[model samples]
Target chain A: MLKYTEDHEWLNLADGVATVGITNHAVEQLGDLVFVDLPEVGAQLAKGDAAATVESVKAASDVYCPLDGEIVEVNEAIVNDPSIVNSDAQAAGWFFKLKLARPADADGLMDEAAYLALVG
Target chain B: MSDTTELGKTPLTALNARIGGKMVDFAGYEMPVQFPEGVMKEHLHTRAKAGLFDVGHMGQVILRAKSGKVEDAALALERLVPVDVLGLKPGRQRYGLFTDQNGGILDDLMFANRGDHLFLVVNAACKAQDIAHLRKHLSGDFEIEELTDRGLIALQGPAAEKALAKLNPDVAAMAFMDVKDVTLAGASCIVSRSGYSGEDGYEISVPAEQAVELTEALLADPDVHPIGLGARDSLRLEAGLCLYGNDIDTTTTPVAAALEWAVQKVRRAGGARAGGFPGADVILPEFERGASRRRVGLAPEGRAPVRGGAVLFADETASEPVGMVTSGGFGPSVDRPVAMGHVATSLSEPGTRLYAEVRGKRLPVTVATLPFITPRYKRA
Candidate 1:
């Protein structure tokens, strides 16, 4: 059960914790992830708000929150080696975990089939 | 507005789109910024293996003397640039600048002697103006021709020679800065053993019709991948190479840009030389006494990348702003962010400490030695 946003963020919600990261398509578009600024733990985030900043070789992009919640954990490993997102964008590349305000918020996100259509 | 045509398209446009290249508008042309492999991968690939680049956007011009003597044409060109064109051997290339009367660089370009004709490559955006300026100043005995329909491709990397040798074995034997007219992949092309990426590479000028075919042929090799403008900038930046408009512009002098090496000593020695070029008065003296501001490399502290237009402070108090960043980005090969800027002469030392004012916060920065990563040009 993977979900996606139009901005290319993917969220995996399980047992009230949602793990998030950018898609492979997004990584390809960004090109050579260099530095990433992760959100502080316990910081409250609203849906569509910027959760982090990712700088690539060419430009910088803002990673938006998929659903309103508070950041509980962040993957610092990816921050040190941003290429993890390029190599394994879906699994180990998870950016952060959010404690969702409501489980229904995840329902609004696009599923794998829907996300594929949007990206295509 | 309706009469104006669309921005020019290179022969590789269709191929780039097919390969999922992220296209962007650059110098009045729609060019790929990067590809599916990403900029970092493409950049490292170029350093380790071979990376192909489409540089057809650059302007190509030919200069021939009406007197039919190569020396006459060389003399005519010497008037505009400070390089000793007469001393340049055929098949060799030299980097130079076209300066205004006040010594400000109008454009930076590469000139090569092709036996009977002199070949020039000017910046894409400045080509029209360059031709107009040369036409206005050049003597009637010299003839100028533009090769707009030709496509330019650069093959760069440590393995570039071996890759190019596979097609034209003679190219591998050519030394640095040498040029040859050869038929590559069945297309007659001008091949030069010079590139901007600080690597042993070749820049091939092919017929427009054969451009895509040549690109496809090269990409078919496992070592060759189509790189985009994004990686090109990073590669040049790592090599401490200047990007014309950003690093050195019309307002920047060659002396300020630390490019005096491009100007020969003989041209600066004589008070009244035979060739009467433009901006001789200002340029000649700067050669003796260095310019006030100099371009230097800066490495900022931490992972926060400093970018262009960021004001640089000389000291800790963040006192008077010394200069600004011209080009700044994360160098994948170097594993850190590097930047180039025009700073005051006193603060241009390799280890001088400085601060960059990013969003009102003074970020610590230090003057670092250039070529942030040493260029791996093949000398032998």
Candidate 2:
């Protein structure tokens, strides 16, 4: 299942783990990406806690965690080349994989149709 | 975003929208912050090629003698600013400042001697007050005309001359700071080989209705790309240019701002027209004895950009701030973060190590000479 947060972060959950990344809309709004600072593996994050930071030439923005989890893995590739966040934000540009402590924490998040309406 | 109804639009607003400019509200105007290429790419592209900017929102005013000596209005304007305007030759431009009674800068502007009149271009945000200041100070046989029907455009970069010469061959003959009247695409225009960007470029002032056509003609060249305010700000910052309200304000003087060069010796204490302009009492001594605080360029030790208003400490553990960063950002051309700020005279020397508190962390910064990138001007 795919879930969205008001801060423009999106998560895909399967087998007690979730893949996390910013939405395409958020990437478009941020313009160009120059740097990305992601949380380290084994880092514990609470829902709504900041997990990553994305900086463009003009401004910096924070990416918040949608659900409480322990960071199991981080995408070092995106850190090496930040443009992937702008080019393939939803898939190849994923920020991290987390083991969800409580899977039901994402139940209140918006679905794709609902998220589109919220953004519009 | 406030009420969009209150924001003004430039003549190129429609064109900016068609080209994917992300609009933002600036100085009560709906201006383009950047295009699809984004700020970083646009900034880099300008350094490599030519970039076009719509500066129509900037104020243009003409001061002409009602019926007197041609230098009469020039002499009148000299009373408000601290520049050698009376000695300005025809078709030449000079950077100037409007000073208050307390040796503070009201606004910085560019003025060109056009033989018949003195042409002035001031900051967009300070235009209203600048016009009123001119009217309130000068009372002789002079007429002030706001050229609202005209629009301004800047084509800047190393390749600017090549791109501009394709349309108007005369532009090739104009040297830096030279102003002349020319015809572009059958529309009469006033062109000057000057710009805010630290590059050899031209600023074209044309009839408002014909601006779009002239812009398209410049864009027809392969080397020219339309840039927005985002790149303009970064480019000027990298050049160490002082943004009016940010780097200089009502509280900053020419000496403290490190703009003593603009206040030529001819206008100082011993010159021909000394002590005539405003604030001569306090400003003259600063030239003799340097100011206590001065503006200096700062290169941060790392990639994290130190932003404006960042507090500065003399040492790594100082409890009180010694200065403040007025304009700071990432310099795309230099590939590092650069900044400009006012600091104590003791700490203003080049290579003086200072600490800038950014996001609650103290970052080491080195005081350096202005202009992270050297300016390339075509003087000849």
Candidate 3:
């Protein structure tokens, strides 16, 4: 299931794990991504904590954790070449995977249609 | 810094918006932050070929001596700045700084000797204040006329010569720091072989009415791409040029900003015209003894871009900040993070190691040389 956060993060939930990445809207606003700083794979994170950083040629911004979870896996491809995220932010540019503390919390997020409305 | 007040528009605002420019409020003017190509590409494009920028919002003014001599105006102007204005020959422009009475920089500007009159271009945000300052000081001796109806555009990069030379053949003969009156596409323009970008280029000042026509004509050349404010800042930063409010301001002195080169020997302590300018008492001594703090280049260890206001420390465990970053970002040409800041003069040498606090982490940085990239100005 796909969901989005008001902070411009997207989640793709599968079983108890979810793949997290910033939305395309955030990519457009931040301009070209020059660097990405991600958290360790096994770190524990609370909702609203800064989990990652996305830096452009102009400025740097924090990518927040949408839900309390244990970080399961982190993507290293974008770290090597951050422009991968700028080119394809949703799929190949996914930042990390987290084992959710409560799987049911995904229902609280906005769906694709609601997320589009929020951004609009 | 807020948009509550009415925003001012440059002569090329409509054209900028028409070409997919992301317009934002910059110093009260609705300026283009970047175009559809984005800042990264625009910056790289300028370095590779040519990029045209609309700087019409910058303040342009003319200073004429009431006594009918440009030397008199230059001498009167020298009372406020620490530069040798009288020594500047006709058709040459020099960088200047406006100093307050107590050894602080009021503003950094460019002044050109345009034969009978002196042409001055000041920062947009400080223009109104600077005009008031000049009027308060030199109105009785000089006639100051602000050129509100002029449009300033910079055509920059290695290929800039090829593009502009197509319109005016004489431009190819000009060298760096040379300012001349030239005609382009039927518009009478003041062309200067100088720009913020470290590339070989020209800044052409045209009449407001013909601004769009000149901009459009330049873009028609294959080598020319339209650039925005985003690339402008990056280009200048990579070139080690200081932005007025960020690098040097009302609080920083010229010697502290590492701008002693602009102060010619004639204006220094032992010269004939020394000790006449504002703050000469405080600034001149620094020429021999030096300032306690100095501006230097910085290279953050990794890819994370360290930006303005990031506190710098001697080490990760240091409590007090040793200095602070004044201007910084990813240098597209350098292909890495680059920065500049003021640190204690003791640690200002190149190769000195320091740390910048970023996101609760101390990122290691090295004190490097200025102009992250080698300048390609046609000085000869």
- List, for all models, the DockQ compared with the true complex: 0.63, 0.53, 0.90
> How far does residue B102 in candidate 2 sit from its true spot (Å)?
2.1
Whole-model Cα lDDT of every candidate shown, in order: 0.86, 0.89, 0.93
Tens digit of per-residue lDDT, candidate 1, span A1-120: 689999999999898789999998898777667888899999999998889889888777899988889999999999988878878999999899999999888888899999899888
Candidate 3 Cα RMSD (Å): 1.0
TM-score of 3: 0.99
lDDT by residue for model 1 over B1-380, one digit each (tens)? 13375877887777887898888878888899888877888899999999999999899999999888888888888888877888889988888888888878889898899999899999988999999988988848889999977999999998888888878788988888898898889999999889999888999999999998888888888999889898999999999999988999867877888888888776776733432567777777777787888899999887867888889997668578898888898888988888999999889999998898864568888998888887777675
The lowest-lDDT stretch of 10 consecutive residues in candidate 3 chain B is B1-10
Candidate with the greatest lDDT versus the true structure: 3
Best by TM-score: 3
Interface RMSD of every candidate? 1.1, 1.5, 0.6
Off by over 4 Å in 2: A14-17, A39-45, A69-76, A97-101, B1-5
RMSD of each: 3.0, 2.1, 1.0
Expressed as tens digits, the lDDT of each residue in B1-380 for candidate 3 is 54478888888999999999999988889899999999999999999999999898899989999888999999988988999999999999999999998888998899999998899999999999999999999978789999998899999999999999999999999999999999999999999999999999999999989999999999999889999999999999999999998998877778899999999999998898987878888899999999989999999989889999999999989898999999999999999999999999999999999999998899999999998999999997
How well does model 1 score by local distance difference test?
A: 0.86
- Per-model TM-score on C-alpha atoms: 0.89, 0.94, 0.99
